[model samples]
Every structure is written in structure tokens, then in C-alpha cells.
Target chain A: MRNTQVIQVEGLTKKFGDFVAVDHISFEVEKGEIFGFLGANGAGKTTAMRMLTGLSKPSSGKGKVAGFDVLKESERIKERIGYMSQKFSLYEDLTVKENIRFYGGIYGLSKNQIRTKTSQILEELQLSEVGAKPVRSLPLGWKQRLAFAVSMVHEPEIVFLDEPTGGVDPNVRRQFWEAIYQASELGRTIFVTTHYMDEAEYCDRISIMVSGMIKALDSPDNLKKQF
Target chain B: MRRLRFLIQKEFIQIFRNKALLPMMTLLPIIQLIILSNAASNEVKDVRIAVVDHDQSEISRALSNKIMANDRFSLLAAPFNKKEALDLMQLDEVDIVLEVPPDFEKQLYRGEAPQLQTLVNAINGQQATVGSGYLNGIIATLNKEIRRNEPLFFSGLPKHNEPVVVTSNNWYNPELDYPHFMAPGILAELTALLTIVLTAMNTVREREIGTIEQINVTPIKKWEFILGKLVPFLCLGLVLLTVGLIASKLIFDIPIRGNIGLIFAYAVVNLICVLGFGLLISNFAETQQQAIFVAFFFVLIFVLMCGLFTPIDSMPKWAQYATIPNPLAHFISVSRKVLLKGSGLADIKMEFVYTFILALLFNAAAVWSYKKQE
Candidate 1:
């Protein structure tokens, strides 16, 4: 149960009927490290991330996240990890503060914790003025940032982001990387998937996948040199 | 439990915040109950009658007078013959044609039974059935009067051969108010429609917006999620039922004759049954539009077979058996039995058991079909 190896997987695989989405993939993510999964649009990055986050059942694999088995103890795994999906997943009709409070509450936060966390998120995201406004009114960049913050409200050991910077501008993507870095500094492992090369450069280690298999695994600079 | 509290709270906030849905869920159903109760009546009054008096005798005139004397029957025409009366009926001017045959008075005087034929328009089944029943009652009373006044004519027959008078009193609803019979069923129906549509649309909407992916990754259990969705809508259904009850009392003076708590007890189980059915439908649907169509499909079947407007006994045998599993049918039956007939728990324990079993089955299917991993 050491914190060093927060995520460890061996021969992880997922299949849809006869189609293999994620082939026999193996990897490990250390605490406080930013791990990036780089692949093309249909490269099984999302499928693999879904298995790790307990959002999908892997076809075959030995995997662990935050000291819990991915297949046998997914509920426990869910409790110890955070996931922000590829789509904008927050409630658009709810107020900014209400969204934060709701996610925090579902994650078993105390009332006082939600109270303080609401204010902290508003202040940190500079959303205090629009705290009462519905999230549908927020800009895309602001909404993505708030989604990331809400995902980490439970302070889990690992946060999984699936193409978290898919459609935002470069300026907002840079701000999003800053949020990732801040989370890594807080000793939360960052497991993110993206095809953006610049975003990949921010990860401590990167795995580039082709089809369903990881073609290369190395530091971004080493990957650049090898390629 | 606390997680469930948060889920329910968030649901309520979203439900109330949606301007279009709020009024539709609350105000619209109440208005429907008020307006529909008055408009959807089965009371057969002012039946248009056309008499064809061929005999032109004293008894034929007496019969026509007796038919018209009742408040329910209205005289439309006094045709000279049966063909003229049939013409009036064909023109859609009258609902019934009472014919007095040529030997009508002569047959009675000769101690033979005279034929009195009545032709009824069978369109609008309820109006036809009840109007015919009223006509029969009036004729029976007239026959009894004739027999009593002309006892000497019946002296040849034995005492036991005389007509046996059967008196029928309608219990619970002495006056046979259509709204009194209809309000409780309408209340159950509207509550059911609201719960089913809302519950069916809820999860599909989350899936449509991709929020389900986020929820699937959370630590919340599947039962907790389903229960969370059900609880809020269950409360709304109960609130609607209460509102309907009050409106029925205020507007229709419908009696709440049974134990009031028992009504709510049955309502909770029935509403849960409806909610589970809705969730099961949502699990099969991938989008809100699909959910709505699927929900509407089932709701239509539920309402038509629920024995609300039509008697279940009159349904085709197979269709009547289909209502065995229909929770709405059972709910409306229990509603009328308890609210109108003053039925106690022992009297309706069978309905309670069946509704409870349906609830469990629907909820189990809903929970099983709602796969987080898939």
C-alpha cells in the first residue's frame, strides 16, 4: 500500500465483442508524476483509461489503482480515483457553486468541507462573481478548469483526464496544464490522455500508442529523440 | 444515505429550475384533473326519445307519457308509425325509438302479452347502455302500474306467475355522480403519468448530455443511484396525489370514505412501481426522445387498460388478463375501493401484494439493465 506506485497494471486489455479496444498493455504511474497517454483519435486511449478509472470492465488484465484491484474492487478504485470525461460532464443547468457542492457531497465531503471548498474553488478559479450563475453561462475554458477542480474535490490519489484539453485555445490549454502541474505538486498522480504534442511535453513520462498497443514509452524528450 | 440526500437535492434543484418543466409537472396535471373530471363524464342524461305509436290507444299514450315524465329522458318526436321513428333515428336526431305495435291495447284486453319494441342507437357504447337501462326501468314501472290497476285482467294467472319486482340500490355512490366515480381514478392516472415520464427521461437525459459517464466513475452504488432518482419523483407524485385529492373534494365533493392513511400507503407502492417502470424504459433508451416515445407507448397501454373510463369486465378476456400486471389498473382499482367504497386493508390486500410484486420486478429489471461498465 506504499504511495510510490499509485497505479500499476500488467497486460491490461479490453475488448468489445470480437474487437480488441485495448491490447495487452502494461504500465505504472508513481505518486506526484504527470503521466500522459498519447494516441490518435481511435487509438484505445479512452478505453484503457476507462478500465483504469473503474468506468469500464477490462476484457483481460491485472491492474491496480490506489492499491485496489481494477476488476475485483472497482468500487474501491472509484473511491480512490477521480475521472473527468472527454465530454463537458458538469451540470449545465446548475449554478457554478452548486455543481462544486454536488460533486463534493457525492464524494462524501462534510457540509463544512463543501462550504470551504466552494469558496476556495470560486476564489481560485476567479468565479466568485458568477458563483450564482448557471454553469451554462460560463466560458468553455472556465468550465473545463472548474470541471478539473471539481474532479479533485475528494483529493483522490490519482486523477484521470480523457482529452481534457480537446477543444480549448492554446492560451486556455496552457492554463489547464498549470492546473495539472498544481495537482501533481499536491502529490496527486495525473493520468491524462491527449494527442497534443505540446501537452505531452508537460508529462513526466509518456506512452505513445498506435491502434491498441503502446508503440513507445519514455520521457517526452527521449520520445522526441527516438522518433 | 448522505450521498442519496445530495442526489435527491440536486434533482429537486434541477426540476424546479427548469421553467417549462416545473409548471408542466405541477400546474398542468392539476388543471387536467379539474377540467377532465368535468368533461370526461359518463352520465347519460337528456336521452332523445322518439315514440312510434301505431296503436294510437290509451296504453300507448300512457307509455309515452311515462317515458317522458322521467328527468333523464327527453321527448324528441311522436311519429305516426315505426318507419317514421326509424327515420328520425337514422337522421341522428334521437337515441332511442319506442314502438307500440298495432294490437298493443287489444292484446292486453284479450289477456295476451303485447309487443313493445324499442330501437336504440348503439353508437357511443356507454350512452347507449345507460340510456337503454333507464328506458327499461321506466317500462318496468309502467307495467307494474298497469298490472296493479288492472288486477281483474290477471285473475286467471296464479299468484306466483305475477312479475317479481327486484329493487336495486347503488351503494357508496347513491346519486351515481360521474366525477365521484371518476376523480380517484384520474388522480391515480395523472400521478402515474408524471412519475413515469419524469423518471424515464431523467437517466436518458444524463446519458444524452454525457453526465452519466462522470456519474459512472463515482463511488456511488447502482442501487443508490436508482433510488436517488426514484425518491425525488416519488415525493412529487405524492404531492400531486394530495393536490388531486383536495381538488376532488373541493370541486367535485368526492368522498374520502376509507382510512386516509391507507390511501397514501397504497399510493407510495404504486408510485414506486410506476417509477421503476419508467427507469426500466430509460435503460432501454439511449436518448431523451427515445425515452419519451417508449414511456408514451407504455403509458397509453396502461391508461386504456386501467379500467378508469371503461369497465375491466367488459374488456376482452385476454386484455383483461393483461391488466393483471398493470400497476395503474391495480392503483385505480385500489383508489376507488378505498376512496369510494370505504374498503379496508383486508379488503384490498390482494391489490397491495400484486402491486408490491410488480414494483420489485420493475425495480430489479431497471437496476440490472443500468450497467455502469457497459
Candidate 2:
């Protein structure tokens, strides 16, 4: 895995009318790095992720994500990045394989590519038996794992997981981390947001946001030493 | 284009997996087409009535027979007095009353005109008018017979000349079968109703479920996303339209005089407008229920103002102006022109233009509402 800047943010600011959700924050994520974004509820981590993912416009400032201009080439950036929302954003009515195929297809994967990727994803998660079952029928742990896998189906250069393991068991979270590590090994940048302090340890680097501003950003051990 | 195919595939999978919505998407239009087509007829028939006969003479019996023979009147009871007849009318058991005077046939032979009275329930004025005309026709026939051989009496009767005659040339619907006229309009209405509800609900559902955010993050363009959601419902609308057409033909035997292709062409344009309205509603609504409610309310108003049930000329000028963009109005006119009047495209160019422009305006509004970033 190469260490190159895949995402660069400079004074990115987002305001919703009067309230500032992400206030003039700046950051950069190197390729194949597990960049953990830590924040409390409403600390603007989701808002910032939204801007980086092109889901929301930055009120001001500038950024480039995956070598695409954030302002002018947001559509281009969108095509190359994957997003897994905090809400376990798989279609509940669709089967696991269907969700994978749908996301892969939307990312411009051909049928053969989706079929092959789906099988590989199912094999990796040991969820081959439930691939044909509806996502709604699966347990929360399985859903989180499936959502993570579905987000990477198109081999996007970067994957954004918003609190991806919100309500899963510890064993499932450990397994989910293994999948993220595997994605990093495959040269894909992993930008994850989580409230779990323990999950921050798995990242290559971590940023803690407080009240729409980054209070600390460094390796976990370095942050603990500073504290 | 690839993203669009994927989005459409996702929608189809979701629709197929959601067992409840699938049946409703396909079946509701057909069921409504069948039921509303029957219930929406304008022909007034089987009106209930009561007869108060005090004469008990052959003339009174003859009048009663004529009334009974008419398909429009159904005699509920023979009331003995005026009070009893009024009581039946008040109870809603009878819609009309035929009152016979106590004078026997001797009055007529004595060269005195016996009086007959018809009391009608006028709450529904159109039905009352039709009932009155039917009763008057029967009385005129009876009067002609009463003076059949009395040239002296007829000559002295102030020359009862029936002048200032009016004729109705019911061009399209000579028989005036209500189902035949209503079926086509109802089918057109189904296109509007189903297309709006399905497209609106589908888009709002995506927003609520957060799949829209996922898709937005993909390389998919805005047009791709919109078209992905739209094309499936358009196909569904066409399928429903075909089913409605089959129902009209097989069950009601409604005629198809003009080109079937032209009807479908108009339907496609009309679906674009309906779906555009749905997309606009989805963009404004925050929840699925809100989207459904708003769409339903607007569709109700559009249908009422479409001139399907009432004459557009009778509506106020302001109300007529409000219906200018209503696709149903144009579709209804086009439908009747084609199905009943056997009119070609040349005959309905204005209607076609109205529908086409309305479709374009709605689509432009929808595209404008779909924001790329929020």
C-alpha cells in the first residue's frame, strides 16, 4: 500500500443557516490509511464527511477528494468513493446479494464483476448462507458486516463508513475491523467515524472533533501521551 | 446510463421484495378502473316513485301502466292519499310522486280537462329534471288520446300548437351509454392517480430510508438518478394503462374508433406530467406519508377540475383558467374526441399541444427541484 494523500481539506466550513456544523476545519488522509474520525453526537463529524463525500456543499473553503476537485468535480469524486451511512444504509427489503449487486451496479460495475465481487464478499464474511436472505432478516452484527462489504463492492479508491459498527457485538466489531484492515491491504483508503474509544486504536491515525472543531489529531498512542 | 440501470435494478428489487407494495402498484389501478367505471356513470335510471290514485278509473289505470312501463321509473308503493305520498318522498323511498285527481273519466267526457300533478324531489336537480320530462311526455300522450275523436273540442281548445321546437343532435354518444363515455375518462384518470402516487412514494421512501444518500455518493449523475426512478414507474404506468384499456374493451365494450397508437402516445405524454408532479411533491415532502397526502390532495383537485363529471363551460372563468394546465382535461377531451367522435389528430391538435406543453413544464419544474447538493 502506498502512502499518498487521497483526501486534502483546507479550511472546510459548513453552515446550516445560523448554526455552523463544521467550522473552517482542515485535514488530509493518505492512501491505504485507516483515518478514524472521532466526535460526539452533533460534533459535525457527519457534516464534514458529507462535504468530503459530496453529499453536502461546503459553505466555504476548498478540498480535493480522490484526485477530483470537490467543488467542480464533485460528481467525479462521487463515482470513485463509497459511503456507508450510520443508519446501516442497505435496503432492508433487499437480500444481501441484491444489496451488493445494487451498490456495485450503481458504481458502474458490470454484471460479471458484481457476481464475482458478491461471492468474494460473502466468502470473506462467512455469510454465504445468508446472502440470499433479506437484509431485514439478518441480525444487527451481520447487517453491519454486510453493509461494510457492500460499500466496497465497486473497489472504490476510498470508503467512508459513518459509525459503521454502531450497535454490533464486540466479536462482530473485531471481525469488522479485520475487514477494514483487509481493505487497507488492498490499497483502499478507509475513512471511518466512530464514538467508540477502543475502535480509535485500530486506525493509523485519529482526529477528535469537539463542537465543530478538531481538538486533537494524531496517532492514538501520541494522543494518549498528550492527554 | 450504467448508474441508471443499476438504480432501476435496485428499485425493481425493492418493489419485488416489498410484497405489499408490489400487489398494490399493479392491482390498485385495475381494481379502480373496474369499480369506478361502473360507479361513474351519468345516465339516470331506476328512479323510485309513488303513485296516489284517487280516481280509480280506467284513465288513471292507463297512466299508471305507462309510468310502470318506462325503464326510468320504479313504482315503490301505491299511496292512498297525498299525505302518504309525501311521507314516502320524505323517507327517501320515493324520488317522484304522481297525483291523480278524484274526478272520474266523466270530467273528460264533459269537456273539462282533468288535472294531474307530479311532485319531484329536486335536491338533485339533474335527476329531477329528467324525471319531470319523462312524466310530461307520458301526460302529453295521454291527452292526445283523450281528444282523439273530438274535432269540435280540439278546435275550440285555443289551437294547442306545439311550436318553438328544440332538437338535440347528440353527435358522439347517440345512445348516451354512461359507461361508454365514462370508462375512457376513468382510464385516463387512473394514469394520473397511479403514476403520481407510485413515483412520489418511491422517491420519498428512498430519502427516508437513506438509500438516496448512498446513491448520491456514487458516480451517478442527477439526471441518471431521476431517470432511474422515473423509467420503472413509467413502465408500470404503461402496463396499468394497457390493463385499463383491456378492461374497457372486454367488459364495457367501449369503442376505439381512432388510432390506438395515438391514444398511447397521449398517455405517454400525460404520464410524463404526472410523474413530474410526483417528483416535485417528493422533493418538497419530508416523509413518505406527507408525500402521499400531498400528492393525493393535488390529484383530487386536478380530477375534479378535469371536466369529466361536469361541463367546463358551466364552471367560473377563474376556475376554467386554473384547469388550463390540468393534463386530465386535455386527455378527457382527446379521449372523447377519439373514442366517441372518431376524431383524428387534426381534430385534437390543441388538446395535444396543451398536454405536451404541460408535460414539459412539469418536467422542467421537477428537474429544477432535484438539487444535487443539500
Candidate 3:
């Protein structure tokens, strides 16, 4: 497999009328790399993430996500990447297995592929017992982990997780990180944004965005020495 | 196409998961459709009459024959005594009572006026007034015939002092069954209510639960998402509309005068106009409660101004003109003309054109309001 840049940006800026949400920011992530985006609250981390995910229009600058243009190629970007927002974005009304099947099916998976993935995910996540029950009945930690797994069901090139471990217990968060590393082993690039500084250690290289601009881009040891 | 099937499947599951909302969406509109259509009629058909004939002569029998033959009055019991006639009137079985006095023909032959006593139950003023007028008409004709034959008594009387009679024909609704007017209107109301409320609430609910954000980040196009949402409601609305028409036909006996296929086609076109209105409301409203209120506001305007309860011709010219833009009004008019009159496509071609344009306009507006990258 070619180890090339999966995400390349020159200067991506998003403005809301008089206010600038995401200033001209530039970065790149190699294939299968777990790149961490660290920022304080209101630091335009989300605006940058949205632009990269092709969910929001960039006011200026040019970028390519998963080899697709950020402008005029958003649909292609969506097909190539998986996204999980901070809101525990799963169908609470749907069962764990059903949620897996639905998300997979929406990515244009065939019936045979959906069936295979459903069983594989159930055993892998150890959610075989409650596959028929609704997601609303599950514990918060379990839901977050299941959400991560569902996001990656279609086996996209990259998984964009925005605060994926928010409000989960320490035990569950550790197990969740184990799965994140496991995903990287399968050559899925992980682009995550988090306020938890400790989570920054898991990245191959971390970029700290302050007020929509990248102030630091280096390994954790280097960043720690500077701070 | 496969993506849309999955998306629509998810929507159906979400809707059915809430046990209460599903039944409420399908049931309330149906109940309202049947009950309101039956209750909307105002034309009075059966007015019972009782005749007390003390003057059992040829004239009295002829008078009784004339009264009974008219469609307005039904003969209850022609009692010989006033007491018996009054008894039937008191029982609420009869609306009018006519009493011919004992000295009937003898007084008229002696060149003296013979009085006829008629009493009307004025409990419902409209029935009482109209009933009495009918009686007066029948008696006046008798009086004119009597005067013409007895020319000796009227030789001194002036001829110009005659009752200037006018005749009227019920051009459209001759039988005056109010159900005929309301069935079409009620069908219009149900389509708007079901389409707007269901679509609005579900759309907003998706936003509230954050599922919309998940779908937004997917490969689904904005127009694809909108179409996926609209197609399900369109299908469900059509099924519900068919059921509503069947019930109207079975319960109220509303005749289907226009093309049966045309009626369904008309409703589908109407759905095209209205389902987008719901989508537009959902796009603007951030919460399900806000969606409900916004939907209610627009649905109320559409239903009330559809001329369902009031006749469009009776409305002010400006308000009548406003109905031009109201989809519900066009629906009601189309249904009534087709169902009751069996009016062909040629007769209702203008309505079809206007509705088609309005539907296209509304759908375009709805699609325009949605932002994939705003």
C-alpha cells in the first residue's frame, strides 16, 4: 500500500459573515496515522473538523480530504470517511446490531456484506447478548464505544472522531483507546479532536490549534518540554 | 437508490418505535375526516306536517292532497280534531299543523271569508318560517281558484291586488344534502393535516436527537436526503387518503362523480405541494415543539381558509382571491367537483394546472431552504 498523505490542506478558512470561525489553517496526515487535534474550547477545532469532513463550506483556501476536494467534492469526501460527533450520535431507538446494519447499508454496502459485518461486529464488540435491544437501554460508556465501531463499519479510509470519549468512565475510555489503536493497525487513518491533553499522547504527532491557528505541531515529548 | 431505501427504512423504524405517535398520526385525521364530513350538512329535508280536517268536504280533501304531495312536508297523522293534531305536534313528530274549521264551504258560498287555522312549531326559527311560507303558497293558489270561479264576489274587487309570485330552482344541490359539500372539503383537510404535521414533527425530531448530523456527514446528497424524507410521507399520505375516501363513500354515501383515478392523482399532486411545506417548517425550527407550533400555524391557515366550513363564493373578494394560493382550497374544490358532480377533467383542467404550479413552487422552496454546508 502507498504510504501517502490522506489529508492535505494549504489554507482552509471558514467565516460566518463578520466573524471568522476557522482562520487559514494548514496540515497533512499520512495514511494509517492517528493524528490528534488539540485545542481549547472555542478554538475553532470544530469548524476546522467540519471543513475537513466537508460538512461546512470553506470561505477561502484549498484542501483535499481522502484525495477528494473540500469544495465541489464534499459528497466524495463523505463516502471515503466516517464521522462521529460529540453528541453520542447513534439512533437511540435502534438496536446495536440494527444501527450497525443501517449505517453500513447507508454507505452502499450489499446485503451479504451487511450480514457479515453485523455478526463480526457483534462478536468483536462483545455485544452479542443485547443485539436486539434498543441503544437507549445501554450504559453511556457502552454507547460511545458502539458509536465508534458503527462509524467504522463501512471500512472507510479515515474515521473522524470529535470528542469521542466525552462523559465516559475511565475504565471504558481505556478500552475505547485500545479499539482506536486496533483501528489504526487495520490501516484506517484516525483524525480526532479532543480537549483531554492526556489523549494527545496517543497521537503519532499532535497539532494544538489556538483561535483557529495551529500554534504547535510536534511529538508529545517535544510539546511537553515546550509547555 | 439503495441509500435512500436504507434512509427511509430508518425513518419508518423511528416513527413506529414511538408507540403513541404512530397511532395518533394515522387515527386522529381519519376520525376527524369521517365525523366532520357527516356533521357539516345544513340543508333540512324532512319537515313533518299534521292536518286537522273538520271541513271534511271536497275542498278540504283536495287541500290535504296538495300539502302531502309537496316534498317539503311529510304527513304524520291527519286527525279529525285539533286536540289530536296538537298532540302529534307536541310529541315533536310534526313541524306544522293545519286546521280547517267546521263551517268550511258554507261560509265561502255565503260571500263570507272562511278562516283556516295553521300553527307552526317555532322551536327552530328557520324551519318554522320556511314551513309557514310553503303552507301560505298552497292556500293562496286555492284562494285564487275560488275567486276566479266565484266572479260575482270579485266583480267589485280590483285585479291588481294579486300575490306577485316568484319561483326558484336549486341549481346545484337540489336535495340539499350537506355531506355532499363537506366530503371533498374534509378530504382536503386530512391530507394537509397528515402531511404537514407528520413531516414537520419527524424532521425536527431527527435534528433534536442529532441523527441529522450523522446523516449530514455521510455521502448522501442534500436533495437525496430531502427526497428520501419526502417519499415515505408521500406514500403514507396516499394510503391514508384512499382509506379516507373509502370511509366517506361507505359512511356518508358521497358519490364519486369525477374520474376515480383523477381524484387520487389530484391528491398526489396536492401532496407534492404540501409535503415540502412541512419540510420547510422543519428546516427553520430547531426543536420538535417549535416544529409543531409552526406546522399548526400553517395548517390552520390552510384548513380554515380552504373554504371547508364556509363557502368560497360567500367570502370577501380579497379572501376568495387568497384561496388561489391556498393548496387546501384547490384540493377541496377539485374533490367536490369530481366526487359530487362527476365533473370530467375538461371541467377541472384549470384547477389541475394551478395546483401543479403551486406544488412545484412549494417543493422548490422546501428544497431551497435546506443547507448541506451552510
- CAPRI grade of model 3: medium
Q: Model 1 chain B, poorest ten-residue lDDT window?
A: B156-165
Q: What's the C-alpha lDDT at position B354 in model 3?
A: 86
DockQ of predictions, in order shown: 0.79, 0.72, 0.61
lDDT of 1 by residue, B1-374 (tens): 89998999999999889888767777888799888888888888789999888898898889889887899999999988778888888899999988888989999878777778878999867778899999998888887788899988877766775667687899999988888988899999999998899889888999999998888899988898999999999988988888888888989999999998999999999999999999999989998999999899989999999999889999999999999899999999999999999999999999999999999999999999988886
Q: Model 2, chain A: how large is the TM-score?
A: 0.96
Give the lDDT of residue B197 in candidate 1. 94
In candidate 3, which residue pairs get closer than 3 Å at backbone N, Cα or C atoms, i.e. clash? Answer: B257-B342, B258-B338, B258-B342
User: How large is the i-RMS for each model, in angstroms?
Assistant: 0.7, 1.4, 1.0
lDDT (Cα) of model 3: 0.85
Tens digit of per-residue lDDT, candidate 1, span A1-227: 35589889999998888998899999888888899999999999999999998888988979999999999999899898899999999999999999998999899999999999999999999999999999999999999999999999988889999999989999999999999998889889999999998889999999998889999999999988987
Off by over 4 Å in 3: A1-3, B38-166, B169-173
For model 3, how does the per-residue alpha-carbon lDDT over B1-374 read when each residue is reduced to its tens digit? Answer: 88888888887787678888656656776788778877665445667889899988888887888888888888888987889888888899899999999878878666466899889999977688888888888888888887887789777766776668778886455666777778778877887788888898888888888888888888876677888888888887887788788878877787786799988888888887888888988999999899999888878887788888878898899999999888888888888888888888888888889889988887787778887666
lDDT of 1 at B286: 91
**Model 3 chain A weakest 10-residue run by lDDT:** A1-10
Indicate the DockQ of the complex predicted as candidate 3. 0.61
